[model samples]
Target: MLDKRRNSNSKERIDLINRFIGLFGKQVIQSVAADREFVGKNRLAFLNRNEIRYYIRIRNNFKVFLPQKNKEIKASHLFNCFKTNQFVYYNKIVRINEQLCYLSGCKLNSKNIKQDFLIIVSFNKPENAQEEYQKRWQIEMYFKAMKSSVFDIEKTYLQDIQRIEKLILLVMIAFILCYKIGIYLHQINPITIKKHGRKAEVFLNMG
Candidate 1:
């Protein structure tokens, strides 16, 4: 991972994407998904030019251009008509700069009138875009495990940045091992806490 004072620059992020393509080849770089942090005109254009499908989340305040209706719309305005767990799609090509994308909005977990919404801008209408967007949380959980749940890497007092990075790498390896063990134990017994679709596969910590 590229780190610049704990934050990655746009060039670093792009280089990482290019590195992934170089290592795995174009065919393997089918699609890349990221949250709003990765959203930018250059990044989106780069992915589009390279024909790499991307499902990047957009902030509600981002402006979107509707090609079909010949009008501009704020991402937040797209959600006004949606209900909880309801997905609204704009399959017609939309413009962000000169780059074209498909826009999708979802009102998630709406039962409590909570303002949970998602905006996805993608290349073409990627199948199951909402499901794909949800996968971002899996990466988040990995970081959570590395920092607090299992490895507790955040409590370390290492002074050298390089050493801290290496230590975190080691903790990452340990987290992977623990995850494997957790999955194995889950398969052996399959005890689930929640009955809903989202939480059905969540297994109790094997540790």
Candidate 2:
């Protein structure tokens, strides 16, 4: 039950939701919201199972699960308990600080604990997460190379949508050609080039 919030009023956004629904089916609930904070601040959904609860928080003191008992409990109560405990029991240890944990029971000739433990810890530096996120620049680099180096997309004179699309397709074809040629050259015999002498030979002949 991972929840994702989107501005659903726009036709583009609605179409995106429809695409997901077509693949995953109607059981995927659709909720319209003005902004991400609305979904985070308001607990508009419920935990269907007692075994586990999943939620996201926006405002500082947001409340979550209610006590099944007649006595009412606020979200702060659960947060306080979790903060104090510093751990949640999932029949065994499940979550530690920021890391997820796993424990194995004894049996089947195995040791008391297995090697499946996972620990997640966050850095205290303000820019650590941002730096990690910035590592995605490789994707942007690929796009830039495709549009400029491989496709010469900026050189295209067409303004019509269909012609622009055809130019994009041609650019993709050029990239594929370059990639295949690179792979083929990499698989050629290096020994044959070495015997041909340094002046005439390609330095990176691969085989």
Candidate 3:
């Protein structure tokens, strides 16, 4: 998933995903959650074709066809149609690039007019989609910890990509060890995180 060449376009993204699948096999992956930048019609189709459950964040301006309402509308417009703090969902087939696929949207939290500021498109029910998408944040946090919070990976003087990747691997191993130690400490002390206002990972790493 590391590419310095900036081959991050939709085609390259799909190719990388397929390559991972080829290496690990489909059973290794259960579901996927990605940011809006990694989502498009073709990419969704690729995930769908492989029967991988995915929840992808969509831009507010992303177009979706609502057959129930018999109209095309932007994702933001759909949000405005709902009341604040209300749980709502729409299940329909959305057309993208002449291809039609199932689209589901769920509102996680609500604003004054738009109930769902963070909209997710998925094949699963909207009720659970946001919860699943939240899992992706763990990966984001891990990367953040590696880059600056703990490892400061960006400060590396090495220019070689291979060496950089190896350094990242070492960092990952160290992170895993720290997390395991953290888990063990948590199990022994059983401290409630709400009281200390410090994350278990941070507290454990400090130990």
Candidate 4:
């Protein structure tokens, strides 16, 4: 990963994306998904220009242009008529930072409506955008395992990029091994899902 004292610049992020796309070739990759951190004008434009599908979450207050209605508005305002548990999707297109994107969102099932909402911008399959976004959980879990649950890599606090990458590589290898074992065990005994479609524990973990 590209790292700076603060957030890595857009160029570095784009370069890293280029490196991975080059390595895998665009055809093999289905789509890329990320949170708001990766949702920027240049990056979204690059992905769209390259014909790579992306599902990225955006802030509720983020501004977007409605090509059909011909007006710019806050992302949440698009769903002004939507109620809790109701989803609103602009399947045609929504312009964010001048990049055309499909928008989908829903208000959370809680009383704090203003504080809880999920808005996603995507290139394809607006109906499945939220489901596609769920894939990011695996990456999040991996990061948590590397930092605290398993390897505790953050405790070392390696500042140098090379050293940090090396440590991550080593922990990554171990994580993969554990992941394989977790899969094997899961196949034999399957993870139980609760009423909410979630397992009490990570079905796949550093076991």
Using TM-score, give the best candidate's number: 4
lDDT of 2: 0.36
Clashes of each: 0, 2, 0, 0
Q: Please say which candidate is ahead in lDDT: 1 or 4.
A: 4
Q: 1 or 2: which has the higher lDDT? A: 1
Residue 140 local lDDT, model 1: 89
Output the worst ten-in-a-row residue range by lDDT, candidate 3. 198-207
Give one digit per residue, the lDDT tens place, for model 1 in 73-174. 787677768776678786577887568888887776645654667888889764467877778788989877776565677788887878988897887787
lDDT agreement of model 1 with the native: 0.77
Query: Which candidate order results from sorting by lDDT in descending order?
Result: 4, 1, 3, 2
Winner of 2 and 3 under TM-score: 3
Candidate 2 similarity to native, TM-score: 0.30
True-vs-predicted CA distance for residue 89, candidate 3, Å: 2.8
Q: Which residue pairs in candidate 3 have backbone atoms (N, alpha carbon, C) closer than 3 angstroms, thus clashing?
A: none
Candidate 2 lDDT, 43-132, residue by residue in tens = 221111111112222232332222234343332333333332233322322221222222111112225563221111111221232233
- Residue lDDT tens for model 3, 24-68: 988987678898788876787787777787778887778877766
